[model samples]
Target: MFGKRNGLFFDGKITLEQGDPEFIELFSRFAYDEVVNEPGAQHPDLDDATRSMAILATLIGCQGVDAYEMMLPVALETGVTPVQVKEVVYQA
Candidate 1:
């Protein structure tokens, strides 16, 4: 499911070679299935857009600039407005 959910943010298909299938399998399960798909009631039924915003805020707070950049498009695709993204960045 790497390419499946990754396509939500990225443009083209994601291709992983045959090295370290374990890493691939675990990352696919967590990033795609768990975080994107099956987010439980951890935040009082937060919607995808809200979750994406929160993720952006957390990334900023953690100084995860690279990860934040990677996730910015995904957050925008989830309907997080540019103003909201800016607010999160400022608040961080």
Candidate 2:
């Protein structure tokens, strides 16, 4: 799902790395809980594609590559298109 880290500072995974330190810190605090405990914390009304699009939109906005990778299978399962997902993150 991700590539190798090129340098010692990073893991070279599919990641998002453009945000304030505070946001990054807070996101780190609960990101695990959200991924582990509340995988469906986002919109539950929409189908997978829409839901995945929402996730993609958010992760890209927050620069959260790990979460994005973790959700990839779900996105695909929910029928999200590569085009749609790419569109969501293209301008990020």
Candidate 3:
């Protein structure tokens, strides 16, 4: 419940509401250490800002409103500016 409200992007209670279940599950497994944690399926070694950029690109490509909104905190955490996010979208 708090995960839904603690962030500004997603309106629903679960990642399924914001993005595909497969995407969420894949990202979760890759983002953490305890899950599937496949070496070949791992996320790229990017800084937080770059990671945000990649996420923004994926969201924009998918037209994922919930995912896009939810990524704001990660973008901020990664020092990815709003302008950067927009730029990535425009470039994509």
Q: What is the lDDT of residue 79 in candidate 3?
A: 96
Residue-level lDDT for 34 in candidate 3? 49
For each candidate, what is the lDDT? 0.80, 0.71, 0.72
TM-score of each: 0.62, 0.49, 0.53
Writing each residue's lDDT as its tens digit, candidate 3 over 1-92 gives: 24455433455544463557678777676677544355544466656688678788888889998988898777878798878877987897
Residues 1-92 of candidate 1 have per-residue lDDT tens digits of 23445334244544453445788899989987886556464567788799899899999888899999999999999999999998988888
- The best-first sequence of candidates by TM-score reads 1, 3, 2
| Rank list by lDDT | 1, 3, 2
User: In lDDT terms, how accurate is model 1?
Assistant: 0.80
Ten contiguous residues with the weakest lDDT in model 2: 6-15
Runs off by more than 4 Å, candidate 1 = 1-17, 37-45
At residue 62, what lDDT does model 2 achieve? 89
Query: Which residue window of length 10 is worst by lDDT in model 3?
Result: 1-10
Best by TM-score: 1
Model 3: CA > 4 A from native: 1-36, 40-45
Q: Write the per-residue lDDT of candidate 2 for residues 19-72, one digit (tens) a residue.
A: 355677777877766554675655468666887788888887887999889987
